[model samples]
Target: MATPEAPLREILKSVSFTQFPLRVIEPFFVADKIVKPRLYIYPSFAVHKETMANDEKRPMLPTFDVKSLYMLTALKFAKYDFDIAYTSEPDASPDGSLPFLLLRDGTALDFKAIMSKLQQNSTELGCATEEQPDYISDVDGDLEMPKNELPSEPVYRTMVENNLLPVIEYLTWTDPVGRECIGEGKYLGSYPQIIRNMLSWIAATDTAHKLKLGLPEYGADAMVLDGEVLYENAFRTLDSLLVLLHTVDDSRLFLAGAPSLLDALVFACVNVFLYAPVKSPVRTALLKSDSTYKPVLEYAVRIFDQYFASA
Candidate 1:
């Protein structure tokens, strides 16, 4: 009789990893089954503390990473079930990214693949159980947009994706104060001094390369990488979204009823800006001079209180 490991043996013959541990590679030779799907994500400071032994219980912590937060919100909206695993190592994922889903059958899924899978199985999935929290959207509830509104969804989504998301990334990764705040308060807090310093340097360099933000002047304190254009575009996008919020009737609870995927996306970005321990120019503008943007902020807050405020 042929075994599943036979093909794996042939495949591994040509693969070499001198530094990789044999214990890690040994799993590939076995056919153990994973019963529940698991979501691998960057560690959250609040979650880390909450799950610590003998620690007092606290309100469920919101996701610290933007991608993790939005993906989590979307999963909750879809009423999906999966276990959460906190990890700092992105190399464990097939695509070398955090927030990937490891399925029961050992298949890994990136964000787009996970969302596509949910859509394909929409009818079969999304049935909220008694154990599920009531704060989430009703699976049977209507979240469909009007026919005319449908066409505009993609446009607004693009505005948020292209403008708003980049600004968040710029602020969090490129801005000196923002990077320090998150690195100290969340991502690197648990690591020892030496390791933390090394990882922080690597993260900063990687982020600069990924976002194409030129480095600050050498030895210059309080200098920001050129983010003027990013901030300008972000404000324009915010103004446009705020105008749309004004046009909507007061009866609606969110930009869309029951909070569509776009709403979830917006909520994730805005909430981060509002609550991040960093000095966010966008957050300052929204709260100070641009009072017109308050409605959008209110919308994001409402979504948070409804779903993520508690576990």
Candidate 2:
């Protein structure tokens, strides 16, 4: 039933149709042993419309879905139509609990492994990697592999891990306005108040944990005040990122030329930053950019226009 008491992973993992009135997209097999289409589950940004759509199943998806989606879209060589399940979080995935892919037998592949497997399959099947005019490095942040062979990777990793992710967590969990948005939009709409509050608390606690580990200087102590500190640090990093983004040329529209995994990751973060219904400090930071952060804004719009315009 996906009760609030149960871990999100349990709710997400149970594939039984009776669990919720959820749709179980059936797969079509080309042969007795060959599965054709696959099932993909990604996080959706729990929009207000989604919560209002139904009474029972109110699982919210993460903005992280966009990254995997970008990889799928950019891989022009592969020809597979995957059915999607927009699921809720915090992801109980084997890979840091992000989004995942379910196989015909219900085997789940976490995000990074999914990309690796796809790339390997494309090679084994003799499909050439997309020779797209731009030579963007294919550096997916979630993949537990060697860093992408791009000069921008270290900066990208720092921006994502240290700056962007913390700010996102702060907005989604710590900020008062962000808490309200998450409560009403992601949980409260479908869950009882107690359950939804717990979800928000857990999310905030996780945020603090992450802040403690990756960036102690961002202030993990005293959350109310810490939230502001985190925002300042996030923008401080973004300030530097803006410098890098400004210098980008046409051969690569995003970090490291063509659309690299960093672009997808950053794209997802920026979308949330720019679009969250709540006016968190981070959003305020962008709004205050007044024109100083023009490059960041343009980059986000450009990606959306190029990839998600029809999505």
Please report the candidate that would top lDDT against the real structure: 1
Clashing pairs in 1: none
Q: Can you write out model 1's per-residue Cα lDDT over 175-200, one digit (the tens) per residue?
A: 76766667544677678878877877
List ranges where model 1 is wrong by over 4 Å.
1-35, 45-60, 118-124, 128-149, 190-192, 215-225, 288-290
TM-score of model 1 (CA atoms):
0.68
lDDT of 1 at 54: 32
Compute each candidate's TM-score over C-alphas. Answer: 0.68, 0.62
Q: What is the lDDT of residue 288 in candidate 2?
A: 63
RMSD of 2: 15.3
Provide the global lDDT of candidate 2 against the true structure. 0.55
Shift in Å, residue 269, candidate 1: 0.4
